[model samples]
Target chain A: MTHASLALESALRQVAAEIDAQFDRLLDVPDDPRADLYRAMRHAAIGGGKRLRPLLVFATAQLFAVDKSCAARVATALECIHVYSLIHDDLPAMDDDDLRRGKPTVHKAFDEATAILAGDCLHDLAFELLAHEATHADPFVRVELISELARSSGPAGMAGGQMMDLEAEKASFDLATVTRLQALKTGALISCAVECGAILGRVPHEGRTGLRGYARDIGLAFQIVDDILDAEGDEALVGKKLGKDGAAGKETFLSLLGIDRAREQARMLVDQAIAHLHAFGPEADLLRDVARFTLERDR
Target chain B: MTHASLALESALRQVAAEIDAQFDRLLDVPDDPRADLYRAMRHAAIGGGKRLRPLLVFATAQLFAVDKSCAARVATALECIHVYSLIHDDLPAMDDDDLRRGKPTVHKAFDEATAILAGDCLHDLAFELLAHEATHADPFVRVELISELARSSGPAGMAGGQMMDLEAEKASFDLATVTRLQALKTGALISCAVECGAILGRVPHEGRTGLRGYARDIGLAFQIVDDILDAEGDEALVGKKLGKDGAAGKETFLSLLGIDRAREQARMLVDQAIAHLHAFGPEADLLRDVARFTLERDR
Candidate 1:
């Protein structure tokens, strides 16, 4: 790897480590008799992979030279939301996957009831962390962050997309329907990460739109690549049972457009996403690397 | 019904109708694209319960002679939380019940993924309603309401209680364990309702504590009576399949202490719950009636 690549990788490695450590501290099982609840929540949340969401926060904040500590709490909060969604998605009623990240799914490692409540707890913890006065953003900004994240994850966004995907399963969906679903289910949080990064960086208004567009384009590209990988990727590398989406009759980009077409679309989107970073000058090279990394990363 | 009973029933019925209508008005179903999500969310939320939470809010506000509009939005918000919890609890991975209030559960009526997303969306709508400064209480009060409800429902509260209860199954829980579990799972929301009522009513701190105590005791009694009824009541009257708790090795007061002793304990709790209402003098008569209703209601 080149120096910048190593710098980006090293930065991401540090992000993963810091997020894991902070999460561990934040979610330590209390000695209360009801500590099982805490433990289940902790188990569901801690020791995740690349910490992609927090990395986005850090990288976005770095573009404007914002202090890392200033972004830490919200970074943790973003992970909380992501983790909660994963737990819920793995429940027996949903994907019913017994494994996640090559480990037992929360419901499998714990019990279904505990997994359900743990997910529920994590959802609230995200908002609770945001609600804290100590987070110290302007009140309106806090409200905006809370509201935006809530909308992105709630029915109109991620949840809604999941519902649409479930409803459209195995039925020949058009490219538009597939793209719309992917945008909501996968892209919403990714876009939120970039938007939040911009928020933390206090990016000027015109620059803010550019950053958001960059995030959106890359986020959608990321999902398209994910769909491509699901069709062709190795199980050991992805750390998940491959092609389960196909087996489940789920709707995905590759399922709708084929691998070649999906790859083409991803390339196009990456180009557009990178274009948005041009106004940032050299300071956004890391972001440009991230856009490329999003499409190129194997796992 | 006697005159007082008739009056209370009619008033509560109106409160329920008004709350539903108000919620219906607040919901905006976007055209075509996202309309299905809005529709599913409305379907899940609009058709449930006697609106006891909202009734409590309205009644408690009445106790302070607060204007009806002052607490109306909160009344709706509380019901939103209650509805969301029920939707989630009835999911196939959770209680897996087919029936609730004499009709199919959301998961049974809809698909599992839709049910899950519907619950999640409902949760967001609840907070969104609270965040709307135009709708109800002041910002500070609204923030407090949001914080309290979030805390009550998350870990260390309702969800925690559910986790403990899940574990309590297959084990012989003592009275203390049973009580603690109920307090968190069932009692927290009930207590929050009464406390919220008082808060919206602008009741003094002492009154808030007194109402909270009343709610807690009555809530516990409500669970005890539910246990006793489940042991002896007809499934037709209960409006759902019954006896699964025993089959699942779930712990309940009647299961632990026998029906007769459980009934005795419930009556004692009702008395204590009523005693706490004395702090509000004659204005709290409705709360006392509700306490008695907890132990005496046929359903």
Candidate 2:
């Protein structure tokens, strides 16, 4: 990796660790015997990952001169949604995967029923966390964050995109169809992270729009890179089983377009993602770094 | 059966038809081609068994001298959540049931993946409908409805109960455990329907509390009657396969207390459910009727 990329990774890791610590404080389980469910949910959520989504929440808030700590609930809520998706997607009824991030998947580590209930509980916790705001400087800003996150993670957003991807499996879909699918499946949450951060940061409407554009390109580019890695990356290095996309006969970007074209498309998306950050000037340097890293990451 | 019970059946059937008609008008397909998903979702929701949940919503709103139409979106949303649960419970990874309400389960009629996606989409759509002002008289009321529904359906609520139910399967559970599980799984939504309607109607807090107590008893009685029927009712008469609970080795009130004792307990709960409505005078007549009918139903 480049020196600049390594530094970006280090900074992101530190910010993510801080975010995880905040989440641990927030998840104070009650004394009820049923509290085991809460323990399972926290265990799945706090387990380590890149924490890219929460970092976006923190980074975008910093860009608009907001206190990073003030946005912890929203960032934690965003990660809860992401973690819930992972839990449900790995269920025996769904993807039925056994490994994720080099650890046993939630269902494999616990039980299928626990995993389902865990996902359901986490999904609700995300909204509850947003609704029960404790630190927002402005109540209306919190409402904006809640409403944006609700819409982004909801039917017209990430969940909708997932259903579309399920339908698109092994089916021939046009570029437009694929774009629309990815825009919701992956792009919606990414865009919501930035939008929520900007709202909490009190960014103007124009800036919100610009940051959303940046998130959208980077989100799609990130997925394309994922598809590329799945086709070629080593299983031991990537952490999870690779080539499952091919085995599942998924309609991935790499499958739709040859590797060279897919790589070229990813690069173009990274460029566009960075261009949208021009409004933030040097304040968005880390965002640009992440966009470049999206296409450059080996795993 | 009894002449009074026959009259109750006619009233319930008429109410179900009216509620189904209203739901039909509200089913709008988005412009996206994935709109079929919403359509299939409606198929799982409408054209099912008795609209008991919606009836509770309308009946509870009526208790506050509010128009049933005032709670229509919330009524629909409650039913949406109920239907989504049924679909998910019928999946191959869960109960793996082939029939529900005398028809093929969603996964049996549709594909498993579609059933899963439909259930997921329905959950989000329920919230979306509640969030929209077109469904309710006031925005604040809609928000209240959304919050109440989430509380009833989420982790510490219905989903929590579902986990207990899964755990209870193939295990010996005491009456306390069975009751707690049933209260969460079935009683949560029933109580929520009644309470949410009162909130939408802007009923006084004390009256809302009384109505909720009334609904809770009715929910418990309803489940007790279901347990008895599972042991005594015919598959054809019940409109679904009977003996399912026993076949699955599920721990229910009947399994804990035996048939006669369970029936006696149900009668007591029904009486208590009706007695709680005494404070409401004539406004709570339909709720009384529902409680009575729930206890006396043969199938």
Which candidate comes out best when scored by DockQ? 1
The C-alpha stretches of model 2 lying farther than 4 A from their native spots are A1-7, A22-36, A64-70, A133-147, A201-207, B1-36, B65-70, B135-140, B204-207
The 10-residue segment of model 2 chain B with minimum total lDDT is B1-10
Residue pairs whose backbone atoms clash in candidate 2: none
Worst 10 residues of 1 chain B by lDDT: B1-10
Off by over 4 Å in 1: A1-4, A30-36, A62-70, A199-207, A248-251, A279-283, B1-4, B26-40, B63-70, B135-138, B199-207, B258-261, B281-283
Give the candidate number with the greatest lDDT. Answer: 2
lDDT tens digits by residue: candidate 1, B1-299: 22236556776678878887876886678764556667766776675566777877777777888677767887887787778788888876677889887788877776776677777777777666766665443555655666677788888688778777767765677888889989988888888787777777667676577777788888899888778767777776677778877888887888888888888989999899888777677777777777777887766
Error of 2 at A27 (Å): 5.4
lDDT of 2 by residue, A16-110 (tens): 78867866875667654356566767778875667778878877888878876677778888988888888877776567788887788887877
* Residues A3-101, model 1: lDDT tens digits: 238767887888888888777887878665567768877776777565777888778878877767657777888888888888888877777788777
Compute DockQ for each candidate against the true complex: 0.49, 0.30
